[model samples]
Target: MQIVTEKLLNLGVDEDKEINESQLVLLDVKEDEKSEWKALSLNKQLSDARAELFVLLNGVEDKEIQDKIIFNYKALQKFRKKENDKELIVEKEVQIQTHERGDVTIYCDGGCTPNPGKAGSGIAVYRNDKLSELWYGLYEEMGTNNTAELGALYESLLLAKKESENGNTVEIKCDSMYSINCIKTWAISWEKKGWTKKGGEIKNLEIIKLSYHLYNSIKKDITLSHIKAHAGFEGNELADRMTMYTIQEKSESFVKYDKEIIVVDILKMRA
Candidate 1:
């Protein structure tokens, strides 16, 4: 508990203030009566509580602290379920046509406003000459720019895997050399070394592993290319805009995909 508290302090959170505030909000929730719990108000409370929980969850490395955080998270999840609130849930899987023709290109970007502050990730997918999908979401807690960038790459590959058939080429464009090299080169050595580099623990190991697996799972010609960020590339520019929009507005999980035309909705993740 002390370690987790210190970690939260290092992340610029006032422990007493934040926890007290969250407790007050949780206490206000009417657990028995659904009629008194307005959707909007309950959502705001859940979001705030989740945000605090994420900060604590992300900051700590100890399993004990993680278990404590998960306990709190489960309580929040239970309350949210009782209220039938689905706004904060995110879809973990998506289905798309596997035989779509032509090449698919994905542009991805991610960053935090203050680099180590609230972070977000965005991706834009183009099939042949038409835009196919757009996705962006805010990180629940504070995170580094690289974490968000790696998340973008991971999500892009995940989408490509779901949307493309075998033998179809998929191109991923991003500006982060660190993220690009991690999957393309560094990850191999890291895995051989038990997920380490220079005998030191690797940062963003979870996302890096996820990205590596997703990259390898695609049985197609997958190309990762670096583009000059903030330059005039159309897809890159839109991805950047979407990333910034998420960070600035703290956008919820949003996904828009082309089905005949573009369709978007707030989705929930399946357990």
Candidate 2:
């Protein structure tokens, strides 16, 4: 109830209206019932009344202001729906829960600039509803898009291995089903042929093998899934951006001495 009250306060339900107590009643009542509170534009009047009440109580959040200024009827309904959902939370608590054995989800991506040029890898972890961690790094030495992508999956699988526990399900999601499939099945055949395989020298055998090892260790307790990227998938795009950002930074690999290196090289060649 405290959570509900705080949220209602956050949502800006007025004290005088006793909206918390009256809302269920009002919400259940028909549109005709609100006739006593009439306006020339009844819908507008109701919308304004609701917005004004909440904005007065919720202190006019930026999102609320935009909605009011735009006067989106559906948006108003959504706010009402969200408020009702919050109220439902008041009725939804379990007094006891422990050792939840959480479900983990990871989003992985990698990319390189100039095709085979500087590259980066990203692994973003989410537990339940919110994001937990993001692992992003660049390959200053040498890397390809596929290499970085594989590396991202490797890192994500490694993290999942670390977080894996008895009976808990961990889901790894990627835009690349190719990457997912590579680690899942191609590993066994590659290992059988001494990591070289008929595929003519499995590129990045070392990390691929390590990823296989981690996957095998946690396979009994994990679930891996491939998801379409950038369909407004929050974690996927976030991880992709992290990798892309790292890729952008990869071209400027050295910080303090890159110019000095050029100057030194020029002077040395002259000598």
Best by TM-score: 1
Q: Give RMSD to native, each candidate.
A: 12.3, 23.2
lDDT of 1 by residue, 161-244 (tens): 755554457888999999999887999998898787885688888889988877877735577889888676667766765676
Instruction: For model 1, name the residue pairs that clash.
Output: none
| Deviation from native of the Cα of residue 154 in model 1, angstroms | 0.3
User: Where is model 1 more than 4 Å wrong at Cα?
Assistant: 1-95, 98-100, 249-254, 257-271
Q: Over the full model, what C-alpha lDDT does candidate 1 score relative to the true structure?
A: 0.65
lDDT of 2: 0.59
Per-model TM-score, in order, reads 0.62, 0.52
Q: CA lDDT of 97 in candidate 1?
A: 52
Clashes of each: 0, 1
Backbone clash total, candidate 1: 0
How big is the positional error of residue 268 in model 1, measured in Å on the Cα after superposition? Answer: 29
lDDT tens string, model 2, 34-132?
443222222331333444444343333355564554466456767886786565334322210222457878888887776687788776667776665
